[model samples]
Target: MIEKAKDLYAQLIHAQELVDNSTRRKVLIDSMRELEASGVNCQSCTGCCCTFISNSMQTDGVQTLELYIYLHDKEMWNDSLISRLNEVIKNNRLDYEISTGQGSSFRRTYTCPFYNSGPKGCSISPESKPFGCLAFNALGKGVSAGENCTSNIEVLKQREDIFENNEQRANVYLKSILSLDWDKLPMPVALLRLHESIGKIL
Candidate 1:
């Protein structure tokens, strides 16, 4: 599974390098619209997708930072939230590493910080949500809901392609701007790093 994730990452990187910025943006916009139209309602579900289950999608540092910035812009940042984020990272840090062909991977399982239990959904705008969150459909392959979901499989597949393509473009944009290898990082760790970065700049 780790190797498969790494290969997908590599492929995205390559695709992003080959594609132009304008074309990437257009694809992202069109795909996002289609994904929204698919309407696989999570309202009735238990928000299982927000929880870091055995095979939940991983987030990268760039997406984490973007989410943090979005919340900060909305005046959501406070000392209590920072402390909670720190505690989350400390409690969930993985002791062992999973080896991917590119390098050793460090990931952990934890409920997303942006997830709210009452509504049991994301606090941020859907547009600001991480690529992993946007790409994932409980109705898609490898999910428990696959059997029960009524969403058309064809539409779901198209959504997956668009999500994957946009995610690659996003990664490429991050790489060009940050000039760093944007390996997928555990959500807690990435959020913690984003908090620290904001502290430095502020």
Candidate 2:
């Protein structure tokens, strides 16, 4: 699984021209920093945005693959990580599909397993973090609670369009291997599914 993931990561890094041009990613991170400077103090506050009470972070296959590779590199992919994912799915009813009335179903909110109360607040890197998480930002000064924060929808759309315009090759490749047919899924569910599929290979 590790080798397979590493190979995929390297392939995508080259294919996506990530090393030469990570402009979109850089812009997203820069925007987040600007928002933080405007008084979005997430560093020292309780992570309300990451809790199941409000979190509904979703990701496509490409994002899930990036996260999987990151976890593997960090040596965070293990039995304990799998257990946490399974527990989150079961405890939060993340597997229950609620119809969206648009020919699709949406999973319930999931508390991010990597939402550590540590200094970083979240354990995942910005590179692998869900776009939904990256786009969400505090709206104004002195806003600690996530209530005042909202997604920079314009930025989110721009980033998403870039991937889609490229035919989402990475996402399609992931689905070919993992049989992940859905366009988007709760982050934990996507990660678990990706992990399960990788475990089956070789």
The most accurate candidate by TM-score is: 2
Candidate 2 regions with alpha-carbon error over 4 angstroms:
13-24
Q: What local lDDT score does residue 60 receive in model 1, on the 0 to 100 scale?
A: 65
On the 0 to 100 scale, the lDDT of residue 9 in model 2 is 58
Residues 1-202, model 2: lDDT tens digits: 7788677657666775433124546667888988777766576556788888789888787778778888988989889998998899899998888899978776577679999864468988887787778887777665555667788989877776765544377667667766666778888888887777777777
Task: List candidate 1 stretches off by more than 4 Å.
Answer: 1-39, 54-57, 94-102, 118-120, 140-182, 198-202
Where's the lowest-lDDT run of ten residues in candidate 1?
Answer: 1-10
Clashes of 1: 0
Q: lDDT tens string, model 1, 40-95? A: 34545555556655324456644565555566667776777777667766666532
Poorest lDDT segment (10 consecutive residues) of candidate 2: 16-25
Let me know the TM-score candidate 1 reaches against the reference structure.
Answer: 0.58
